[model samples]
Target chain A: MDIQYPLELIGTFMFAISGALAVQDREHDLFGAGFTGFITAIGGGSLRDIILGSYPLVWVGDVWFLYAIFLGILTAFLFHRSLGKLRRTLFLFDTFGIGFFTILGVEKALSLGVQVEIAAIMGMFSAVMGGVIRDTLTNEVPILFRREVYASACLAGAIIYLVLNHFGLDRDPNMLISIGIVIIIRLVAVKYKLSLPRLE
Target chain B: MDIQYPLELIGTFMFAISGALAVQDREHDLFGAGFTGFITAIGGGSLRDIILGSYPLVWVGDVWFLYAIFLGILTAFLFHRSLGKLRRTLFLFDTFGIGFFTILGVEKALSLGVQVEIAAIMGMFSAVMGGVIRDTLTNEVPILFRREVYASACLAGAIIYLVLNHFGLDRDPNMLISIGIVIIIRLVAVKYKLSLPRLE
Candidate 1:
């Protein structure tokens, strides 16, 4: 069994948890929260597949992903009161998920024979777009456009992965290293309250 | 050339105009407005194709669409001051654009062999999702969810198209009839201030 498969499912679950929690204090009903959770879990990956013309979107083809989303939403609803105390844990999971998603997206795009540069963008898109769409749906300016270093971390990791691959690094080690860099960047950025400079 | 070709371009142009104008009073720069306009022009169609697993998206396969979007953005920027005075005319064009887009989306989905119900939903999606995305990007609740008769008008027309085609109506006449229904529904709804009942 591929080690990435279980981790991918866990990442999806964490994303859904974050999405569900995002709307917890809002006026949304259970169905609305579920819908948001589902979209947040699948949005980035489905978009990546759609743009690359990949058929049978990942969740559509794999029922397990749906189960994972359902479980995540359920977790969010059940733990809403206590979840506030788990903010740090959730943040760590979310950051780790983005890191994993970024590398996976880069790998998938490269395998599809797209230009390396486009692959890097696709990687960033896959990690960030779900949250972007979530914020959009909830009527907030997307975090991507905010002063956060969120997407930049993914892009940096993607570029690093491309550079390493170009230098004949093996796939497994490249994936691990790139994912590590992404997680580290995110952790450091958040710890230091770092952000990109605002446009004048 | 198919008669629908020019109409499609005009519809795209109108959608872009609406999107750009939606952001006119906002703090967005020209690039932001242009990006909004482009997405509003292509969002629906590209989303339809993506969900249906169709490749080489319309704009990607045809350059004229790009020209139409660019011209639309240019028209918006050049006429930003005067465009407000033309609100009624713009409304007519926007309504007409949704009408045309609804029928075309339904036809494409039918041709792709989607279920009739799914086709109807896709038709509505094609007509309204651009505005939804645009509203979301601009940090407003989507017009679709704001008690507008917008998407329902498209759904009604799409269902009518399917029923007519199922009863042996020819494609050309069916297209015209379905589009007319959508336009009429929209006009009447707006004139009468019709809206969906709010959830309790």
Candidate 2:
């Protein structure tokens, strides 16, 4: 078994928990919260796949992903109060999830022979769109259009991955480097409270 | 040419204008308004096609649809205040949009051999999802999940279409009846200020 499997699972779980947590303050019951979590974890990748004409959508083919999402929702429900105090821990998990999803999206699009620019957009979408959909469903402006530097981080990482691919770098190493870039950029941005300049 | 074609074009135009109007007070520029209108008109059908694995998404194959959306946006931007006074006129257009989309979605699903139950759901999605997404993007709760009874009308129409198909009714007449049912239900519901009972 490849190491990527476990990493991907961890990323999925964290993303799901993040989604569930976002729904906590809203007037949602357990089922609604769980559904929100499931969608937040899977929505981005599923949309990308559908646009690329990839069949059997990623979650549709794998039952285990559902298990991961269920576990994530359970964790969020049972320990949300305690988890709220651990902001740094939650931030780390989210950072890693974004990194992993960005690479996954870029690689998948590239494998399907999409243009590099489109592949980068797919990468950013994979990393950010789940949260966009979640925010939308919860009746809030998506953070993407606001102060978050999240999509920027994903796009930068994807560009790095594409450049490294152009240089004939190996897949695993390229992925690791790209992920590292995204995680570092996001962490630094969050720490410094950096945001994009608002359009007038 | 089938009469459905002209009706569909009119429905699409009305839906686009409705979407553009939704963004009127949201502080968006012309491009933003136009994009919102285009999405509102096409989002539901595009989502259904992607989920059903239908390629070339409806708008991708038809440039004429873009022209209709542009015209709708322009009309909304130019005469919004005047149009607002014609509430009944706007209501009729929206009703027609919903009815036409519901039937078109159901027929597409049936052609793809989707299960009748799923096909009904798809039809409802096609009629209501664009507005749902539009509201979400604008940071509002989707009307479908509220007391609007919009999806219910689409679902009722789709079920009627399916039953008529099962009885081997002619396609055009069946479509007309289903569309009529949806429009009447919606108009009556709105006029009476009726809504679904809230879930506790």
Candidate 3:
């Protein structure tokens, strides 16, 4: 089994949890929260696939992903209080999720024969678009436009992966290195309170 | 040329105008407003196509659509003051646009062999999702959840179209009749201030 498959499932679960938790303080009912979680987990990847005209959207084709999302939503509901206390841990998982998603998105786009530039954009889109959509659904200005070094980290990682792959680096090592770079950039940016300059 | 082709372009242009105008009160700049207009014009149809796994997204495959959107945005920028004064006219145009979009979406989905039920939902999605995305981008709750007789009208039209087509109505008449129903429903709802009951 490709290691990426399991990792993708884990990432989906983490994203779903975060999405559900995001609406906890709002007036959303269980169904609303669950819907939000579902979109947050699958929005980015499915959007990328859709734009690329890929058929049988990932979750639609694979019932397992739905199960994972369902389990994740259940976990969020059942352990909302406990999960609230685990903010730091959830932050780490979310960071890692974006990192993995970034590289995987880049790989998928490249394999589908998109231009390198478009692939890098698609990679960043895959990592951050879910959160963007989530924030939008929750009626907040998307954190993507306001947050520190989030999508930029994914773009950086995607470009690095492409560069390494062009230099004949092995796929597995390149994936690891690229994902690590994304995580590191995110961590450092948060640790230092770094942010992009605002448009004047 | 098919009459539907020119009507589609007109609909695209009208949607873009509404989108650009939506962000005018916000802090978004010209580029931001233009981007919003572009998405508003294409978001629904493109999303329907994406979910249906149709390739070479309409805007991506056709330069004419882009030109239409550009013209729409340009019109919005050039006639901001005059357009603001023509709210009633724009509302009618917007209503007609959605009406056309709903039927086209249903027709397209049926052509792609989606289940009738899914096609109905896709038809509504194709008409309303652009406004939903536009509202979301501007950090407002999607009007779909709060507005009166918008998407529901589209869904009703879609079902009507399907029923008529199933009963052996010709394609052109079915299209016109369904679109008319949508417009009439919308007009009555707005005229009467009809709205769905709020969740308790």
Return the candidate ranking by lDDT, descending: 3, 1, 2
Instruction: Output the number of the lDDT-best candidate.
Output: 3
- lDDT (Cα, tens digit) per residue for candidate 2, span B1-200: 47877777778889899999888888898888888898899989988888778778877888888788888899999998998899788987788788889989988987876667657767987998898788877776766655355778888999999999999999889988999999888888877987653213
A20-104 per-residue lDDT for model 2 (tens digits)? 8886775565545665787799889988997788876666455567678879988988898898899889988888888889989
TM-score of 3: 0.61
Model 3, range B1-200, lDDT digits (tens) per residue?
Answer: 37878988888989888888887776565655766787788889988997897877776566677778889998998898899999999999988889889988988898899899999999999999998888777777787987798999999999999999889999888888999999999999999999878779
Against the true structure, candidate 2 has what lDDT?
A: 0.83
List per-prediction Cα lDDT, in the order shown: 0.85, 0.83, 0.86
- Give RMSD (Å) of candidate 3 vs. truth: 6.6
lDDT of 3 by residue, A37-89 (tens): 99999999988887887668889999999999999999999999999999999
**C-alpha lDDT (0 to 100) for residue B105 of candidate 1:** 92
Error of 1 at A11 (Å): 14
Task: Give the TM-score of each candidate.
Answer: 0.61, 0.61, 0.61
| Model 1 ranges off by over 4 Å | A1-46, A55-131, A137-139, A144-200, B196-200
Q: Pull out the clashing pairs in model 1.
A: none
Select the stronger candidate by DockQ from 2 and 3. Answer: 3
- Candidate 2 docking class: incorrect
Give the range of the ten consecutive residues with the poorest summed lDDT in model 3 chain B.
Answer: B26-35
